[model samples]
Target chain A: MAPFAGYDMPISYPTGAVEEHNICRRGVGLFDIDHMGQLIVSGPDADAFVSHTVSGAVLDMKDGDARYSLLLDDKGLVLDDLFVYRLPGRWWIVVNASNLETDVEWFTLRAREWKGTVKVEDVSEATYMIAVQGPRALELLDLMGTPKASSCPRFTSGEIVIQGTKNLFGRTGYTGEDGGELFFPAQDALGLWEGFIKAGETHGIEVKAIGLAARDSLRFEAGMPLHGHEISPSINALEAGFKWACDFSKPDFVGKKALEAIAAAGVSRKLVGIEITGGVPREGYDVVSPSGEKIGTCVAGMFCPTTKKYAANAFVEPQFARPGTEVAVMAHGKPKSGVVVKRPLYLPAYRR
Target chain B: MKIDSAARYQASHEFARKDGTVFVIGISDHAQEALGDIVFVELPEVGKTFAKGQSFGVVESVKAASDLYMPISGTVTAVNDALGGDPALVNRDCYGLGWIAKVEATKAGEFEGLLDAAAYEKEAGKD
Candidate 1:
């Protein structure tokens, strides 16, 4: 166990991160993600308030639908990347645990300024979250009495009952595999954790307890960005290639004007994929040009278990952003030659 | 984790035990367990010399990379090349197959200063 975001969380099980990562890729894996933050945004002005607060089209989403979104500061810098769910009569926003307090403050301040019946409530302490992810994830979940979670398409959220209690179920996950996330009262954490483990054994299904270590690699292999690394207050959508999550055509939002102005003038930096030739690249490593001048920084990098290559994400000058551009990353105290590659390193399994 | 009675241990988890005329050194089982899954180990070249507490190499786990410190001042005679292909041997048998290096000790007196198995276990237990 390790301390993360003020919570004592499991980093991995005894089987190790490599096996746990393979289990999620080839078989099944379970994640205890209770540390994530869940918030409730409700009242008469919810529809407009949500659309105004987030960059995604939350107003158009049908009840029980969810979509990826982001919160930006007034200067168009990323505050946090989040998932916004349109449930019954409220907006459910799930965010990174590290940014939970900041998000609540941002939303509460905005709601008060916009002033209506809209309400913001932090329900994270009262709830537990877990993810069942892998190629065979759905098959194992189907055995439960919960009716047809498979029927819902990806990114849909609804309700399912386990042990006679209703649980919030979403066909959403952080890993690039096909899977679902479950949300319930904190008291149900242990029973559900054991129940899934038992089911995996009883049915001869392959299941592994995935921790934060494997979770990071799983997302890294899929070429997804973690907030504090790839997208943070210092890194914006314009530089991170995350403009797809922003809707410039939509009406006035917090950062809409600033993003439009920045996009028109063009961005100075670009986030590109780098493959180290002789070693693993790591976050904060200096990305140097062939002439030995620093041009950029490595956002994240490691030995991708699935790819068997040392891959990294870097923010570099636009001239060096093209595929096949040669560069070097300072790894383990030495500069290792590398080249820019076409992204993403790997796509989500569903797309394949 | 069991401490090898034949070896003397540094508080940082490295162990040194007399082999024929040299000392064999490696990290303790408790160190491997705390490091989780190790993916790569940067081994120093043969014949490299270091002070009693200098950094010898680096151990890269799935989570982070940590430096391996020299348990006693010596000239490295051999390195466990097997770690290049399988670093998890350290986690499996830290004291045996995972022995990191064979060093010709220049300061044999430092070995006597390190904690013995019973003493090391008592110190590690406090963690």
Candidate 2:
């Protein structure tokens, strides 16, 4: 186990990260993602409060629907990327583990400034989240007798009962594959994990216990953004390639004016995909032009198991952001040749 | 993981075996296990020379990249070119086909400083 956001998280099983990653692509993989935070917002003013605070269209979401959104500071810099689920009567917000406390505090302080009644509760301690991802994920879920797991559409959620315990789940995941994230009480975590393992065996599916290392590689290959790596307070949503999440048509929202201005003036830098030929380019490595002049820095990089090559995402000048542009990444103190590719180095295999 | 009985070991987990005047060098089984899956290996040229304890090559796994050190000062005689295409050979068979390089030892007493299998097993056991 390795330390991740104060949790003793598994980095990989004995099969190693590569095998686990391959299993997720070919079969099924399970993850213990209890470190993520769960926040509940409810009251008379909850809808308006949520819609105004986040960059996504929150109020338009129907019950059992979820949307990817972002919270931004006053200057339009992203504070955290999150998923907002419209439950029966409350809004369920799932934020990154490291930014949980800060996000809760921000929501509480903002609630006080609003005119109507709004209550925000931090329910992270009482929640346990498990992710089942990959091509055969739904088949395993169906074999386990999880109701609605097979029929639920993407970005939708439903409640289910497993082992006589009530649980909630959403057809969402960080891996660009088909999956569902199960949420239940903390006390039932062990039973649910073992139950899934047994169910997988009964159905002849190769369901392996995945770790954070493989989780990162899988998500990286799918072109998903990590909290600290891709989306951060230093980067705005537009430059981070999340302009779609920012609803400019909304009348009033935090960072709306600034985002509109940025959209009009156009962004100077853009996040782009890079394929390195020589060595692996890790986070914070410098991206240079053909003549070896530094242009930007790599925000996230790794040896993509699916692509079988080193790839990365970096924010570079607009001219260098186009696909097929020649660039170089500094790895091990030497510049390695690469090309700027399109976002999502691999096409998503999501069952939408 | 098995430690070769005929090979000499370094504290950093490299093994050197004498065949005539040339020493076949590779990382130990314990080192390969610790690194997980081997993805890439950067080997020295066939004729490169290095001082004792100098970094001679690189071995990268999914988790990290580490510098492979020389056990003794010598001139490289041969490199296992097969590792360039399939670096996982080090993880699958670290003692035999996974041999990284063969070096012509520069001095006669260079093998005297390395530890035997029993001593290395004890040394590796502590971690």
Candidate 3:
């Protein structure tokens, strides 16, 4: 186990990261993601507060829906990426574990500026999250007779009962596969995890506990942005290729004016997918052009278990971000040739 | 977990076995286990000469990359070509099918300075 976000987290299971990654891609894998922060926002001004703070169209979301959104600073730089789930009377915001305290403080301060009633509560300690991901994930859940697990569509959330425990089930995951995330009382975490494993066995699906290593590789293959690696305080949503999450059509929002100015000026750098030909490219490696001019830096790089190739997500000049554009990555002090491909190196099989 | 009794070990977790005049070299099982999933390997080319303790290649796992050092002064005779396509051979059988290279020993007497299986087990436990 390794220290991550104040929690002793497993980096991989006994079978290792490769096997765990294969399990999630081919079969089913379980992830204990309890370290993620959960915040509850409700009141008369809840919808207004959410719309004002995030870069998503929160006011248009119906109940039992979830939207991927980002919190940005005044300078239009990202503070963190989050998922805002609209329940019956409240909005549940899930943020990165490392940004829990800062996000809570940001939300609390913003809520005080509301003219109507608005209350923000940090419920991270009382909540636990588990993700079951793979093509067979829903089949295993169906065998378990989990209510709403099979019916929930992508980016949707609903209440469900698992092993007699009430929980919030969301059809969302980091891996580019069909899966659902379960959020329930912290006390029922172990029971639900064990029960799901046992239920998977009945359906011939070998559900194995996955660790942070596989989780990272799976998400990286899907081209999902991680907080510290892809999007950070210095990186904006436009450059990170998250313009879809930003609802510029809204009248006004936090960082709206600055983001509009940035959009008008055109983004300087763009995040592009790179396939390494020679060696693995790692973070902080310089991306160079054909003429040996430095272009950008690699933020995340790894050997993709699915593609069986060394791929990376890098920020490079807009001219060098097009697909099939030849670029060189400095690996082991040598310029290894590669090409900038489409944004997502791999596509999610179950995306609707 | 299986250590060859005939192989001599280095404190850095490399193992070398005398096979005629050429010595078979590879990482220990413990080293492979510590590296998690072996993904890529950068092997030294044949005929590349290196002194004792010199870095000859690199082994990368899903977690990080580590340098592989020469156990003794020798010239590379051959590298395991199978690992170029299937690096997991090191994790499955670190001592046998996963052998990294065969080297023609320049100083045969250097074998005497290497730790035996028993001494290696004792030293590895201290880690």
Candidate 4:
């Protein structure tokens, strides 16, 4: 089935969504993320230019290290969430597939207006992203390539030779598990995917060829905010609980001033997790207090596989931000009980 | 998968089995397959009246939520309470134990509009 990201993505395997979630939680699941955009920001001024365009401190990052950041307009609304990596001479910016065309256009327009030099090129077609997520992901990936579990830290990546194949590897995952995501050529994807599946068989790894359906749920459980829902141009990063990504200490970056103003003014709204006691909380569900008072709105909600109950994340008035705060969700014309909880519905088992 | 001809179906993916006044209602095999895993089921309350083609409840899979539309106008007499604790039963045995609700048909000719197993297979695009 097609998904909101504008891809006719698979909902799950013929075995179904339950099996796919279970497979990834207990074993490992492979996902085809070829549709995501990969851009190379090179040239002599790549480092300085990237720092100016994004929200995070780029100069502090070392080669091969990856940091989660957001590209924002001058007004402080997020254009998109992206992963930035410091390569040898240039930088690599990986953006959401659905926003590829828009992101390229936006970045190119800014690059042209810049007083300094920065070469931004779209390299999406040349790269293919495959994510191996779940508890057994690292082990399964190691079988296909070299094992670097002990050395590689979380949110970091490196160039590794796997199964005689040279590929870019990162110790990151959307699922709340210890795993890695690899980037290689589209031609190499099918082979490496099947190879991992075969190698994972002996280790009791259930190979789930996951699609976008499970991808959304996995990211939600990991407390990772999405672009359109949680971090749109109308939404502020601080309100989306991404204040950590904004660095004022850096020389300066887009939206830094606006973020500082919001932070100082005290956030009017903030993102918080909610567990639905009465029903499945879905995206766009209205948030209300127990007495029929409107508080905020849910951006993402799902029936959590791990918890076996309904869970959601919402951007609510900051007064209701405390954990255990009682709330209500309006669904099917009925008000259901909900409560504010921790940020991530589940904790990620990053390879520390 | 192949569709079973003996199983009667509806365009909305609902399946029905009639015996005099009582008809067992649930989604078709094609639906269960298309929906992937059946995680949560919100069956209509017993003794609730619904018009034909009206939404009675919802079926939540791991990925998306599907509304369960009434195949025929009727009053809900009973629900499959077992689904409350084991919703996956819908995925495992959708036509049998996974049945949604038992209804007392409001109109006699409503059942005639539903498709037989053969017609349903074609409508579901399984053929």
Best by lDDT: 3
Which 10 residues in a row give candidate 4 chain A its minimum summed lDDT? A142-151
TM-score of only chain B in every candidate structure:
0.97, 0.96, 0.97, 0.92
Model 2 misplacement above 4 A? none
| lDDT over C-alpha atoms for residue B33 of model 1 | 85
Error of 1 at A148 (Å): 1.5
Best by TM-score: 3
TM-score on 0 to 1 scale for chain A of candidate 4:
0.95
Which regions of candidate 1 fall more than 4 Å away from where they truly are? A277-280, B106-115
True contacts kept of 2: 0.39
Model 1 per-residue lDDT tens digits across residues A167-193? 888998888999899999999899988
RMSD of each: 2.5, 1.7, 1.3, 2.7
Per-residue CA lDDT of model 4 for A219-246, tens digit only, reads 7777788777888988988888887888
Best by DockQ: 3
Stretches of candidate 4 off by over 4 Å are A3-7, A113-116, A147-150, A202-204, B1-9, B19-21, B62-64, B105-114
lDDT of 3 at A11: 95
Which has the higher lDDT value, candidate number 2 or candidate number 3?
3
Tens-digit lDDT string for candidate 2 (A18-102): 8899999998899999999999999989999999999989878999998899999877889999999999889999999999999
Per-residue lDDT over A95-213 for candidate 3, one digit per residue giving the tens place of the 0 to 100 score: 99999999999999999998549999999999999999999898887767557587888889888887888889889999998988889999999888999888877767889999999
Each candidate's TM vs. the true structure? 0.91, 0.96, 0.98, 0.91
lDDT for model 2, please. Answer: 0.89
True contacts kept of each: 0.50, 0.39, 0.67, 0.56
DockQ ranking, best first? 3, 2, 4, 1
Question: Which structure is stronger by lDDT: 1 or 2?
Answer: 2
